[model samples]
Structure formats: C-alpha cells, structure tokens
Target: MRLILASTSPYRRELLARLDLPFETLSPQVDETAIPGEAPPETARRLAAAKAAAVARREPDAWVIGSDQVAELDGAALGKPGGREAAVGQLSAMSARAVRFATAVTLQRDEERFHALDSTLVRFRPLSLEEISRYVDAEKPFDCAGSFKSEGLGIALFDAIESRDPTALIGLPLIAVAGLLRKAGFALP
Candidate 1:
C-alpha cells in the first residue's frame, strides 16, 4: 500500500524517513486550535487523527500518518512561538520548570485506524534572559513548540530529559509509529 505523511514539519519528515519506507507528504491543513478545557494529550491525539483523516479523504487507498506535539506547562499548553519575542517569552516562562511534551501519531487507511501517544518530560535549567536571548538568536526555533528543539542546540537548555522515546521530544515518536505501522501490516526491520 502507498504511504503518506500528513504533515509539513521537516523534523517529522526526517524522522519518518528513518523508517526507509517510500511515502509521499501532503499538507494536512487541519486547524490546530486547542479545545476549551481539553488536556494536552487529548489535543495532540485529536489533532493527529484529524490530520490523517483530512488527507485520507483525498487518498483512501493509501495509509496516512499524522502526528502532532504539544508542550504542556503548569496545566496549560504552549504552542509554537512564531517569532523572536514569543520564543524568548516562552523560554523565560519555562525556565527551571518541567515541561511535558505530548506527541501523538495516527495511522489511517480506509476503515482501519491506529493511534499512539508519547509523553516526554523535559526539565529546563534556570535560564537568565541573556542565555534565553542567545539561544533564541542562535537557533531561531520560532516555529517549534516549547520554543526549543531538543534535537538541536536547544538540548543545552535542558537540565534533564525523561522519555521512553527520545525522538518524541523532537516531534514524531518513532517507537510508537513503528508499532502502529507494524500493526497495520507494514514490515519494518
């Protein structure tokens, strides 16, 4: 069966490429707005499923994979920064705190559907404004949730990371994705 990734994120695309499976990418075009009183995990899961379903509407014959990540701090969800000011503010607010990254993945094909969620805990070190400013300037992670990229120089901002799948912090959860794909009859060595 043909495989399709329903996301435009480079990080997710790179991670999916590691599976060595030939797949095409299509923009999901799903609204990512969080629902009122919704938990971070649920938001991620819902978005993931929505993305897959959006693309599946166009390609019912292909297996579509959709994924999303949300950074939760103090029971609130922190989305992408989208600019230097927002990135700095997000980093500052998250300094010396533990943030839970809820990454969800969904696979859909015709009547079949599979789903998974990976939660990664990242503890940020106490960061001064200068440090946050420098990191923001160097990495420009404005488009990334949590205002940092755990796979890049942003790793230095964390004091500790606890996760079952390290790649989940980057965006896509490979371990969970592999399991879902395997259950869908895809062979993976």
Candidate 2:
C-alpha cells in the first residue's frame, strides 16, 4: 500500500523525508481546538489520531501517518504564537524554565492503527530580554510552539534536552513512528 502523510507542516514534511521512503502529503482538515480541561499530551495524541483517521477513511487501502506536537509549561498549553509580540512574550516566559514538548504519532491502515506519544523535557539557559528579542527577530519562529526552534537558533537558548528520541523535539518521533510503520507492514531498511 502507498503511504500518505496528513499534514502541511514544513517541519513534519522535512522530518518525514528523512526516512528516505517515498510518501504523499495531504492536509487533514480537522479542528485543532483543544477540548475543555484536555491535557497537553492528550491533545497531541487526539490530534494525531484524528489526522490519521481522517486520511485513512479516504485512502482505505493505503497507510497513513499523522502527527502533532504540543508544548506545555506550568500546566498551560502553548501553541504557535500569533505574531512577533506574542512570540516575544512566550519566549520571555520560557526563559530559564523547563518545558515539556509532547509529540504524538499515529499510523493507520484500513481498520488497523498503531501509535505513540513521546515527551521531551528541555531546560533553557537564563535568557536576557535582549537575547530573546534578537532571536525572535532573526528567526521569526512565531509559527513554532513555545516560540523557539530547537533545530535552529533556538538551540542556543537551551542548556540541556532530555529526550529518548531527539527527533521528537523536532516535531516527529521518528524512532517510534518507524516501529509503528514496520508493524503496519511498511518496509524500512
């Protein structure tokens, strides 16, 4: 069966490409609003599964992979910022703090589905207002959750990252997703 990715995120597209497996991409039209009282991890998983199922129903004979990420600090969920000011505020609040980024991945084929969710704990070094402002201005990672891009300039803001799968921090947990794909009968070298 052919494999399909249900997302338009550049980061997710890039991460998926690393597998060296050919796949098609499609946008999954689904509401991403979090349910009332829904936790960050749960939200990520739900969205991932929703995306996969949405695609699976359309391509019942093909494999579909869906993923989502959520960053949470102090129990408050942080999604992509709206603009420069919001990015600055989010980064400022995260400076010198530890944040949990949960990435969820789901694979579905017909009636069978497999999934995984991985959380990466990242500790940021004490950041000056000036530093935060410069990073935001230079990278404009406003579209990223928590207002930082660990794969880019945002790495300078971190003192350490504790994660079983570093790619999870990049937006997709490739290690776990690869396992799920293999179980779903995808050939991976």
Q: Estimate each model's TM-score.
A: 0.99, 0.98
Q: After superposition, how far is residue 102 of candidate 2 from its true place, in Å?
A: 0.7
Of the candidates shown, which would achieve the greatest TM-score relative to the real structure? 1
Question: At residue 123, what lDDT does model 2 achieve?
Answer: 96
| Candidate no. 1 TM-score | 0.99
The models' CA-based lDDT, in order, is 0.95, 0.92
> Per-residue alpha-carbon lDDT of model 2 for 127-174, expressed as tens digits?
999999999999999889889889999999999999999999989999
Clash totals in order = 0, 0
Worst lDDT 10-window in candidate 2: 177-186
Candidate 1 local lDDT, 18-95, one digit each (tens): 999999999999999999999999999999999999999999999999999999999999999999999999999999
